[model samples]
Target: MKKIQNFFSGFLIIFSLFFVFHSAEAGFFDWFFRFFGKNEANVKKEEIVLPKYYRLGVSSVGSGTVIINVNEGKINCGNECRKIFPEKSLVELTAKPNDNYIFKSWSGCDYTPNEKCKIEMNKNVTITANFAKKENVVNSQQQSGSHSSKIISSSVSQKSSSKSSLVSSKTNNSKLSNSLSSAASSKAPSSRSSSSSSIFSAELMEDVFLMDDDGTLIDSDNKLIDKKIVEKFYTLHPQKTYYDFLSVFPSFEPGFQGAFHSIVKNDVKGIGGPQITSSYLSDSNKLIGVNFLGFGFTSPRIKTEDDVKNNLHYLVHETGHQWLAYIGKEEGFSTATHYTNWTDTGFIRDGQQWSDVMGGSPWKDNGDGTVSEIITNKQGFSKLSLYLMGLASQTEVPDLRIVVPENPQDQSPFNVHVRGEPKTISISDIVSRYGTRIPSYQTSQKDFKMAYILLSKKSNPPTMSQIDAINYVAKYFPSEWNFVTYGKSTINSR
Candidate 1:
């Protein structure tokens, strides 16, 4: 009985202790489970994240429309424009001028005035497309003017208004026109005579070759010799005999300064071509001509077609320096000409600007010692260069227009008004014009033919007539051909 009582007493004590502990900390175990549940709820809330977006704004001044494109979305802003885009999106903006208006400049964007603007959308951005009315009276006045008048028109736009006003003065015009005509005529005959005489005909080139024989410094006629003879003479006399032969040619003499010679075995560093000047000074201290020691017209060994072609190429390239000097003096584009380096992808030579070739693209050098046939065969002045040099008339280059798509994946179309009619050209035609093989990129003939068509479609505008745009894609995006052609049906089609 006593043992049973003791057991009951011990049970009462344990029960009392349990009751006290439970009452003191009520819901302790429930709270522990709820803490983990709350942590899981917080994690789920973190998983529900928000996306990021940015704003793009565009506007225009004058008679033009601003076309803005982000991905597949497009907005045509006549006066004001705005849109939202994902971060790091590339937006293409184009300014289209109305009839009788021209694109002047761009503001609030990184782009040339007339060219297309490519923007990378990182933050809220605004851009403006500026335009101006095409001057009709000024254009007419330019057409009727003499060479001096044309120079004034091209070089000094600010003074054009006053010069045009002078055209209306009939009393002054009669005297001015007569004096200008007489002066122009007198200058023309002498200049033409000098150039015609100085031109190196095939026969003259051969004659000059004989004169340089035996490094005799001077020929029997007392004329300074060519290449090695000149080099020998220059070393002996330095200044007195240097460039004496070039003085007779007025075309080469106007901007003549001096030359540099770098002889490497039988070949010259730049193939005996002139190192074109980057400065536009009427009198510059820069090296204008270059002579290779061994490669001269005197070498009797250059009889093959390839040899003749190569020599002619060197002659043209060297003479190009003289033309560049003359162009620089009139148009102030001297700094645009530059030497060809391996990295330059564009056709514009070093130191020359875009307009130097009338927007003609730079020719790429094939490692096998051949350039594009279009460049070599034509061997003519660029349309813009011709205009600057007074070689081409206004009618030669009509209202040229290029239409680029809002998306790079879209087809860019180009149109030119010929005889007041718009002519549409296919991608194949452009490729044909450029040739099937690209020497610079070492593109295979088959690949270039296929890629040219595909790239023409993938171009930002999908269609472009501007030689600048055409050459840009052909040169810079050679690798994107297959992706744009077979991977997708159209540009940005994916």
Candidate 2:
């Protein structure tokens, strides 16, 4: 009788305390409920944690306009503009001057690069876009738009949004759940979705790369850059879903010169993405988007501007892998992702080659029924390669051929003589051999973008010279591509 009375007294104390402070949570509530043979804890006042939000104020000191681009929307700031965004959200602001005005500078931004400003929202911040009248210029055709969608993720995300941003929770510190709730004065995006899975599926690994005020997914010890950092960079871009290809340039050696890096983490196909197919190995059109990662090693290989310029062919060759190399492999005619060479039985006459960017060299049409390699390494795309890249229709692709040598020189494609017969293969033969590309030029992506980064093995940032060298590659890639592709396709790397 004494023991039973003491147990009843303890239960009453716990029940009374639980009801008295009903707004707060306590494990004793569940502990006492167990005595009543109740399996459910009867959670009445479950705690909920909210995501952090911040306010961004934009102002202009001169006569100009500022276009602010967030997750998927753009805001035009005439003179003053203000908005609220969630933490870890990326904001891009571009200044477009009036007819006679010119962009001067930006203030209160992280850093102004290529005449644009970017801000990562973590706290209440203000930015000023300034402009001034042109002094005496004929027509200031100054560009005023973003160059690349490079995402700069902040490792430290626990920063405060406001002073009273803390939430009340139990002692156990239960897992925090965050939701994209409505902000007090936030303008919701009307066009873009919160997720990018509908278009670019990275084996559903997109969320793993995203961040919040709660935590970040980036893992690194000494900040050695790799595909993870590169993937994260593209995953955070505002227009990630709208893009067809996401190219990443690292400063480190990836063992190979370049590649159309895949983002799939498993063996699932059809949505594997880029340089591979979603359905089968034959149907390459199922892949909608891809990631291309490349690197240029320093020294020995590249000591002068000419060497860097010459090594460009290697990078371009790998980029062509997005839709090349396999075109003639199955037919036993084309070389390894390139045109048929001396090793293959396919041969060409002493005539000018169509496109040698992928392979083949300019041959000197010798009068004695033999062609010689005048200069090696053709700089532009072949008509067939262009057709595969979806930049040209099959009707535009003409016949192609491979020049064979008389005296086989140990299967090497160097300063040799093209003194053998020619194997002339028409575009129809290729199309008949290896089925036509499904997503025709009409539906294929024509414009592409790339993000250039200086990856380092150590935590130290890249030197100014290293950055300039990589940037030099970025600068020349577009024009050279245009010259090769006959201005049909556009590529931008900035």
Candidate 3:
């Protein structure tokens, strides 16, 4: 019985070895463990291999300009690109597999065959090859199935390396995305509250200067200085750049033409319009009380009932008159013609305004003689000058001229009784008006020499012959016209 059992065991062992050897040869083990095999069912089938150095160019309809670039190991597109794109909704080009290299389209492209080619984005134009996908095969006219074997071999090697790199890259990218998302979410709440507080603070301030009948917040200089009230202006624009101040002023209202005309005609004299029933003198002396020019600032304290009705207007009007005087007194301002003949009605022009343009602010007088000032006195002149510069779009250099009177006579007659039409005053006309002789007020030798030097320095200053005459007046004619020296230099004696 023992011998029979030993023979059966030996036979069973041999049969097991034979079956194992045959299964390995016939791929029976692979079929049994199909999930782990390298067949189509187990692994992803390879598609057309794309090159490492490749780009996908996209175009769309209704789009202006488009440029995509690979920078800092990332993709960027849209308005960030400097290149301008044609307007389009959809325009795209894709790739296809050939043999060793991928085939790129110059025109309409899709992945599958039999996709109808139609111009949906651009209308009425036949499709043509504007660009190619592959730079190496760009010029080749013919298509071929055969590929460079060396390129294929290199591509396979590169693809293996790419797979490894992609795996590591994906791990890094996943970690980065989580970090950025977390950081943004954490900051969102605090940022939102800050923005809301800023907005609320601004609304509180707008209620203050919301005055102009036109809803405009005008500066003391009469220019539309701000649209929002003072508090809102400072709140919204925490950083006080020139552009911030610019935003406060509103644009000229189109419907207020009649209001502007009435203000110009009634408050300001010498404005060239037809005769009015009001017989206010249009001459220079009457203009003294008229605040043609000045600059100031407004504050919350100005809201007193008395100030609201009268004081504001008085302050505004007076500053306007003073500004007109200053602007007229400037060395080269053609408007000086108006000052030289302050009494002539011809001094007023079609567009000029004494209340609005000159001072920008108009005030009405209360029982108190003291006019309320908005801006501090120190900044008043500078503010007035800035307002004028803004009106004329003057910067760095002012384009205005100031004309001093040669005769210093009162100009309030409303008619021309002088040697010539008011417009006749030119560089040469100044000498004729002065009669080739300097006035008596400029009697200092040093002051006389400085005046001549400054006259020479002006690219288009008064004439040198006129300067020489002015010098003689400063040195010799001491009893006449007690005009102060006009030199920028302060010291009169050598």
Candidate 4:
């Protein structure tokens, strides 16, 4: 009896406290909540973190529309990509910081007009949408069955608005629940619905590589020096070394194979092209066997004049290839130009965004290299197309067969090669002019090192491309490759 009475007394005290707090106009809880509400309402803004010098943009390809919503570290795509049989669309997102976040895609494939892309929402955030258009849709699915239907995932939280209302359990976290609920109720897309089973998905991964804030993707690291900074010595004095105006671009389907094979043959010593991709294997498996150029040109920073120049050059060059791919002329041996083919009308006109640096020019016709014709020459173009069709392969660079020819014997009299159509050099010729010994370069000459070092220590070692650049610079300019002694000031000037 005594225990029961005590328990009842305690319960009564708690209940009375709650009732008083709920009703009291001047209670601590009431005053505290009121103050908080007033402050929150009065505060008209929130702080947004941005890079010192960074830009973010979106580009759409094909007949698809893409809407990206960004807020407080959350991102979503609305109807970004929808596959219409014989009609396809593309949407791209580019970010500068090397941070991790979630991405959700609401894609409508399977030719379902009613099936629109949706987003899973979480937290208070803002989002923007962009769209791209294309000509008549064609069903190339039969030929490219190897391709998977691109999907925008729901790696982040998402919510969808539907005609028939449905209820979802309130999340335990009140703030997150409220944000998600608001997003779902705010807008029902002005699109139709379908029974398609394709679902939106998202995931958090390492920062995307070789993608500029401008949304361009590059594939090589050679651009580091050429794109980062301009060397005053090279510009004024012009000491011609083998690598003057060399510009390397990422190859597409067939071109990718040729480029891969080039690396395997010239860079990766001992690696044989035949062993790279066996015809008996599937296309996806073949990629694994090839010496895919490590994604190098994707570094976000342009530290020097060379970097800016090279990056811009490579950007336009690779974008040209992508442009070709966007159109139907990706496979055939057509000249690289800004001209568009209106086959239906039997006319070809210059593309609106075409430029000489991109398509074909005088460089494509005459150059010193064996595969001359711009980098888009017959050989380069042919190799790329063949590689894509699994008709060719690129192995890793083997160490054994690097050939160093005598300087005087080589055909090209010039020791250095500068920017032009396809920048290249004979190793024998460069070594003779630049000397077998390393040159006097400074560590500051290469800026991506700092970012690469930090990322490597925090994550994986510098990627293959990073390693190659370091090796090349270190071998030719040993004094410049300063060891970064952590927690000590022995080598660092900064």
RMSD to truth, every model: 25.7, 30.9, 39.7, 31.0
What lDDT tens digits, residue by residue, belong to model 3 across residues 405-483? 3344622221112222122223233323322211111321122111111111111111111211222222322211111
TM-score of 4: 0.17
Please name the candidate that would achieve the greatest lDDT relative to the true structure: 2
Worst 10-residue lDDT window for candidate 4 reads 200-209
Which one wins by TM-score: 1 or 2?
2
Model 4: per-residue Cα lDDT over 349-431, one tens digit each = 13212113322212221233222111111111222222221222322111111112234343221211122223333324322
Task: Estimate, for each residue in 3-79, the C-alpha lDDT of model 1 and write its tens digit.
Answer: 99999999999967766676666554444445446534433343423234456677766655677764545445545
My TM-score estimates for the predictions, one after another, are 0.20, 0.44, 0.16, 0.17
The TM-score of predicted model 2 comes to 0.44
Stretches of candidate 3 exceeding 4 Å from the true structure: 1-203, 207-494
Question: What residue runs in model 2 are displaced by over 4 Å at the alpha carbon?
Answer: 1-227, 234-241, 252-314, 330-332, 343-355, 364-369, 376-378, 404-415
TM-score of 3: 0.16
lDDT winner between 2 and 4, please give it. 2
Off by over 4 Å in 4: 1-287, 290-410, 413-455, 458-494
Q: Candidate 2 on 1-494: residue-level lDDT in tens? A: 99999999999998787666753554554655655657464645664343455667888665556778765555555456566677778888998764346688999898799569988987778899888876654421122242111111211112111111112212112121011112111322122211332111111111112111111322333222344453454455534443334444433334433355443222211111234324221132222334444434232122234434555654566566566655565444455456654422212224533435555544444566565444322356766677877788889767665565566672444323445655567778877765667667787666765444334332222222233344345545666766666788776523
- Distance from true location, Cα of 65 in model 3, Å: 63
Q: Candidate 1: where is the Cα deviation over 4 Å?
A: 1-209, 212-303, 325-336, 339-379, 388-390, 394-494
